[model samples]
Target chain A: MIFSSALIETAVNEFARMPGIGKKTALRLVLHLLKQEPAQVQQFSEAIARMRQQIRFCKLCHNVSDEEICSICASHSRNKTLVCVVENIRDVMAIENTQQYNGVYHVLGGIISPIDGIGPDQLNIHSLVERVQQQEISEVIMALSPTIEGDTTIYYLSKKLQGVPGNPVKITTIARGIAFGGELEYADEMTLARSITNRLPLENYMQK
Target chain B: MIFSSALIETAVNEFARMPGIGKKTALRLVLHLLKQEPAQVQQFSEAIARMRQQIRFCKLCHNVSDEEICSICASHSRNKTLVCVVENIRDVMAIENTQQYNGVYHVLGGIISPIDGIGPDQLNIHSLVERVQQQEISEVIMALSPTIEGDTTIYYLSKKLQGVPGNPVKITTIARGIAFGGELEYADEMTLARSITNRLPLENYMQK
Candidate 1:
């Protein structure tokens, strides 16, 4: 799109650099900012810049943190022995929002996708294994995406944890089945098959 | 959502404040920024802040510009006597992208929407009327949206311009009809009916 001012063009270009945003959406965002007070826009800009510049990754879990150790890792109430492995920081937030898991999180940064050239070595696998070995951790839950890559990552991590020179850390994965509120007829064949094969008793289902 | 860091939360909140963006999308955007280099993120932040701080509106047509007069208003090739009235700066860009019109534009900032509490006084209607009266403009094209509020704004402006104490300027509205790629069967009755009513002759269609 032809921008009347160079500043607007530059600002739109910056917004368009984001993954999902296009030129039109970028222009809309820029126009929205243009309509705001200069101080508010300045606050927004500073917030983003500060987040990027000062944000730290937790040494233990690799989740975004303001300090060396993330709040999840530092918390006294959370189960430090139980670690939930996720694909990214967003997953940690998603799982945290559910408030069902009281365990700390290990953000893998990304899943092991051979097509995208991301492998086990590129992730925070070494630190996770080190945490398992050094700490008195009882379980490591794989909470990655229910994809082929997620399975591959889980398999790889399980194998690595098995070789650690200590008591074997119990490895578990989040259940794979038809989601709650999902219609049985609408479910994919794979999910349908898995749900039937891993069917739980009524007592077990209701207790959870 | 529970955020580990306040900085990330603040940035995400800023992004979520934008129209059409929600908390999840805001988190995704903030995460994307976190993965970028510090200098790149700084540049993006600076561009937005600078655009908001330094951008100016054209003194004449009220289009966004680096100078007092917009490039369209200053251009020697564009038709000075033919003015196109639009709702916003994006509308100006949309028309400019078509490259069909050689006339300058007058941005109204917004249309007359009583429900939204926006009226002629809230818009740049007075400046537009003054421009029409003072300049030797031959024709004024009403290129506002095809909405009740748009028509109301057009009617209000036309009435104001008619009181101009000199030579009369011809007023015309942009043609309303079916979109080129839209299927006739799927079009609403009002649009289809209007398309039939305002149907152009073969020679006129071919020439344009």
Candidate 2:
């Protein structure tokens, strides 16, 4: 059997590691890269390396950022009092593309999946609670997915944040902006059901 | 709305440049990278970069190669006299996986697509013809797809390779190892049918 160079095979294998790319698609992409100008390939490689070297999590929100704090967290014009909690950076981008929410975001890194060994301690939950307790944050909007792990994260976070002193922060989840068992990233921009429907009382949530 | 950092966004945009990867999928891939340890992300990026930097084209066969000539072309044990000319590296891999043809290969880089402004001169046709004229080659098996462009390429190469000196250069095609309108990459390995039904004569092709 004919075998491509190890370099080409390595790149193809990396592409195959992506969510949906198979070996054929990976080979196609690698071949396309090979056909491109060397400068363009260098740029592609540099971009990926730069992403890893330059990007970091926002200190306050745990969202991806170039600086210590993300643009949303750094922007003074944004409503710091209103924090929207999400599972990952993709959710942050999804919400950003809508240009609707004027509030900041808090990324949990992931949901509470016991089977996957993800729990509240493994997430950025402590910083989220600290942010609410330290700032004049009036509301915490849980914009997590509608999966069981998502629900478990929300329940765990709300209980933890309720014990914080002073104004005793108010926590609310996005009115089921998504359907049961639906992924937040796949939800149509306009068809999301939870933006308004699952709106629960923040005060009532604290009491519970 | 929330925004992912520009560095992260830049990486996503880079990935989005690949065929079939949209902004969403790019973001998904970037997030996956972000979650990985810094060393893993470094490896992923370096693998892609090194692919272009380290790989070279085989001088003889024009397939991607680590050294001067590809393994298939460099191996003295392979059928040196029989050359299977294909459109790209993927086709080389496809034929290799079949384990049927023990001959060497010549990658044409691409086919003649007039609509895409690609002509015979734009491909590696000249090198192929040069190899046939200079080497002790006997057969030139055209293993391109059955598309109009594939047909056009085969016709052009056949006309160019005619009357070359040495062992009466026989120009043949892959017959129909591929289905009508099917892609070479998608053809099932086991169900490949070109060994029998698809075999057509270059003389018959010339008559058309």
Candidate 3:
């Protein structure tokens, strides 16, 4: 859209650069910010700028953090021996929100997507391996998604862990199948197949 | 969600403050930015900051601009005697994109929405009326939305214009009702009624 002002055009363009934000939505967002107090807008700008400029990656698990070691890895209350390996910090958050697990996390940053030119080296795989070898971790849960990249990364990690002489870490994947409240008829073929293959014991299934 | 970093938390809070963005989408956007180079993030930051700081408003029509008078109002090719009144600069851009109108515009900052604490006094309504009285504009087209606030503003403006002794301006509203390629059955009752009542002559509608 041909705006009367170059400033509006520039601002809208910048906002539109964000993923999923189109021109119309960007214009709306920019206009919304324009209506706010100058100090508020300054705060918004600074928030983003400072976050990008000063944010650090946790040395242990590679999650985005402001410290050398993230709170999750540093906490004594959580089980450091059981690490939930995920694709990114966002997954760490999702798992934490459930409050079902008391284990720490290892954020891989991304999966090994061959088509996207991303491999194990591009992710935090090396560090994860080093952590498993150096630390006293007993189990490493491969909590990656059920995608080609996720499976490849898990396979590669398991192989590497087996090769490490002193790194006798137990590797397992999160259960995949029909979700809670999901009907058998609506389940995808792959999920249904996996659910049947990894069928739980009758007594355990009936208990819940 | 428990963010490992304060900077990420602050940035995500700012992003979530936007109209349509939720916590999840905000986190995704912040993570996307984190992947970008610091220089690129700085460009995004500067774009918004510079735009807000240097943006100017057209003195006569209150449209956003980089100067006192906007390009549309200052152009000699545009019809100086015809002015299209709109609700905001966004409407100005929408109309300009049509490439159908050659007239200048007067952008009222917003409509008179009392529930939202917005009144005619808060808008650029006074300047618009003054322009009609002082300038040689022969026609004023009300290109506003078909909403209650839009209709009220038009009513108020028409009454104010009629009181001006020497200002003999013809005021007209844009057509309303079913949109192009819209099914008659799907149209709301009020729109269908208005479309029938204000039906155009078959020749006028079909000629072009």
Candidate 4:
């Protein structure tokens, strides 16, 4: 009936709110914090607090950054003309970790899920279109998940950008290095391998 | 070669320092925070910071507390004479959750582990001795783990308290609700069942 200190309880409750943490795990984490040096806890709290305060969405690519433009978007060495569109900042990081692509990224924030009430307007699609038209973009790669919502967004984007005037930006998708209904986040190394190799040209679909 | 934003990378590295969390998990958590509303992140951070600033060890029992004394120690309804000596505050909470014991608790901070160079002095044994001498305590229940280190600590405390004069406190250990070499934290339901039921009287060893 009687609980531990309210402050400790509050912190434990917060941890329990996380995806996988339970009450016991939360208690263990809280107790560990109690055992840590005061300065360590201070640093932990400050780091979490400053995470948002110190970081922002990159104005151009929408990747998380401390400044107006993310490092990838600002870098001159990256192929700015080749823009890879992703669902979120995590996806951006995932592609970046692969080190296979030397292009910039555009975070869509989320896929177009009508059931979830997420439409094209809710995403950064307008900005992506604007970037293609305004910038010297030669290719726009869709590296989104292979989910139905992801496919819908890709189809919508391709339809909207079809036959645009200057240079005709090539709209492509990262070969489903992911399986049907599988998340890009959980794709295995080998599966990701075959997908990349079998990446079909987007131009072939346009001809049909 | 190129990392995520330096601030974000730094935050992820700090999160990775926690037990069981790796760089990938840390990045996931950091990105989760980045996606959250700034206010939510602020709340999460402030919760951790306030926890450390507002909570302190109970002066009387050495358990985490928001006030001078912990809830169990301050409650007038609980048995004041029956003291449960535990290895840590977590044990105190565990016993409290069972709602089986009405006795107060004395947190030892840790058990005696010579291998870890944790001797009797490193624990709160002196305070326990003083508590028994000063208070109208009748029973001292050793709820320490059933490990060799736990046994050594119980033996040492029993021997020390046996020399004290007036009101010879009866010392008993929680029936080894623990298996040999098993941590008290991971004991199963049936084992914990038999351990509590099989608690033995420490006075039997005193005569020897």
Best by DockQ: 1
Model 2 per-residue lDDT tens digits across residues B1-208: 2345777767778888988889878877877877677787788778877888888888998888899988888787899999999988888888889888889999898899999999888889888888988888888899988888898988888888885555568989865555557876787764465534556688975864
> Poorest 10 consecutive residues of model 1 chain A by lDDT?
A143-152
Give per-residue lDDT, candidate 1, residue A114.
Answer: 97
lDDT of 2 by residue, A1-208 (tens): 2356888777877878877789888888887887778788888888887888778778899887888977789898899899999987778888888888899989888899999998779989889888887888999999988778888888999888888888877788765455667887899865465455656679965863
Per-residue accuracy of model 1 over B1-208 as CA lDDT, tens digit each: 8998999999999999999999989989998998899999999999999999999999999999988888899999999999999999999999999989999999999999999999789999899888887899999999998889988988999999988988989999999887878998999999899989988999998897
Q: What is the TM-score of chain B alone in each candidate?
A: 0.93, 0.81, 0.93, 0.84
DockQ of each: 0.81, 0.55, 0.76, 0.53
Q: What's model 3's lDDT at B141?
A: 95
Clashing pairs in 4: B175-B195, B176-B195, B177-B195
Candidate numbers, best DockQ first, in rank order: 1, 3, 2, 4
Return the TM-score for each candidate structure.
0.90, 0.80, 0.91, 0.85
Error of 3 at A140 (Å): 1.6
Mind giving the per-residue lDDT tens digits that candidate 1 earns over A1-208?
A: 7877999999999999998999989999999999999999999999999999999999889999999999989999999999899998888888988988898988889989999999888999999989988999999999988889888999999999999997999999999998889999999999999989999999998987
Runs in model 3 lying further than 4 Å from the true structure:
A196-208, B114-117, B185-203
Q: Ten-residue segment with the worst summed lDDT in candidate 3 chain B? A: B160-169
Better of 1 and 2 by lDDT: 1
User: Model 1, stretches more than 4 Å misplaced?
Assistant: A185-201, B177-202
- A13-33 in candidate 3: lDDT tens per residue? 988998999999999999998
- DockQ for model 4 equals 0.53
Worst 10 residues of 3 chain A by lDDT: A160-169
